[model samples]
Target: MSGRLQHKVAIVTGSGSGIGLESSLLFASEGANVVLADVNLPSAQKGADLIKDRYPTVKGIAVKCDVGKEEDVKAVVDLAVREFGRLDVMFNNAGIMHPEDDNALNTEDRIWDLTMRINVKGVWWGSKYAVLAMRQNPTDEAKGLHVGGSIINTASFVAVVGSATPQIAYTASKGAVLTMSRELAMVHAREGIRVNSLCPGPLKTPLLMDFLNTDEKKQRRLVHLPMGRFGEAIEQAKAALFLASDESSYVTGTDFMVDGGLTNAYVTSIGEPTLPPPSSLI
Candidate 1:
């Protein structure tokens, strides 16, 4: 029931806030030695501090990392191995969706490059390095002769469905994540490393809410949700927890949707209110 990840060591990128932050806490609660890596050093440290404060027995560290840079991402995985003695889970959760990432025609080359660099390239770098580390030290019980680990990449539902909202760069990058994850999963299945994507719909994370400037902007997104509500950060964290733990040992190369039924509904109905209606989604 508890300590599902006992003795596991993990690296969660973009742990400054939102889903990353929530997942880091949950991983720690489940007994994983988590490395909170973020571009913002203070934010990452704050999250790590909170976990250490609450669970003194748990081990966690904050690392300043920009997932867009391969070296920084590599450093995150290295730190985990150096500090924890082994690496078991790698959560590539850092991403960006700038205002300039509108429709293809409106989106600029700079925005496209930035989004892909962080979202796509970052995952590649993280996955590349994580595989290297996981391969060296396989702790998870093996089915064949391979010591396997878990790799959870944060993607979005937009990757599967065409979004009229048009964050072309953001959506495309996530699509890459989904396909890349599957590829890695298949390649490493023989090696014992399971790769998967965690696809979340419109969650109330700062990454999404900070961009919605008006009530109408918020409603445009809300209308698509069959549940008529945004998802909570904790909800996604629980999903990550399952994937990170051995409970999902058999699950791999799959897209785990944590959307509030947004992807399933063609004509969505407003449901019971959980989070208050946003006056200004930003």
Candidate 2:
């Protein structure tokens, strides 16, 4: 059977690991040629290599991109178009949660600037350039392609609700992403281009796991999560795939929350659900 993203081309930033890498692999599996953009060239190349080995029919390329820089973000989009013939999806997933990020009074200016550069400005640059390339897409009736693309910006559940955990800079940056995506979606909706923010809750990715290092830290956030478990990268990847594919063609300017009931939580349950059989934790 044909894949959902057959004949499409996608760009996934921060593809060295975490949600970006998983989304890259999943996009390739769905038959889209993917451009893995990350500052860590080796990790991005590894993702490309995996695509080459596992999905022989599709193509994957690694581009060293510091998403904070507009030029770097532009280069990745240009590379995708030059190599794959068109751009279909832009997954702006690169971001930084600086270790020093804390409450407004505790955080330094440099930390706030650094976080904004990568987390907020990166998405801005990615969307700006992706829209330019998407506008140039030639309609191909045979391929079921059009002169438009999907932009999935990685926001967070914190963007919608306040967190007692602080990380004020990170929270502010994510809120910017949501608003930026909404505005971009409105501007490009008539042109067939779609922009949506992918708001994932507390995830089991390095970005979160590294921050919630201690058991106390982990449980503090867990108590508020109605699902009682951190989300996996794969779960977010699947949500992204839906947004990237034509399935979400009409779904633009929306904050697509993949959070496991974190935003809807009031009080916590007493215990976690039983894990399925053969769980590694068992």
Best by lDDT: 2
lDDT per residue for candidate 2 within 1-282, as digits (tens), equals 158999999999999999999999999999999999999999999999999999999999998999989999999999999997899999999999877889989999999999999999999999999999999998899988999999999999999996658799999999999999999999999999999999999999998888887898888898888888999999999999999999888899999999899888875864955555685765
For model 1, residues 1-282, the per-residue Cα lDDT tens digits are: 278887788899999999999999999998888999999999999999999898777888999999999999988898898887788899999999897789979999999999999999999999999999998874444322235589999999999986757689999999999999999999999887999999998888888887775688788888888777889999999999999888898999999998888788775545654554697566
lDDT to native, each model: 0.89, 0.93
The regions of model 1 sitting more than 4 angstroms off are: 138-146, 271-282
TM-score of model 1 relative to the true fold? 0.92
Q: Name every residue pair that clashes in candidate 2.
A: none
- TM-score (all chains, Cα) for each model: 0.92, 0.95
Q: Give the 10-residue window scoring lowest on summed lDDT in candidate 2.
A: 267-276
What's model 2's TM-score? 0.95
Question: Worst lDDT window (10 residues) for model 1?
Answer: 138-147
Model 2, runs deviating above 4 Å = 272-282
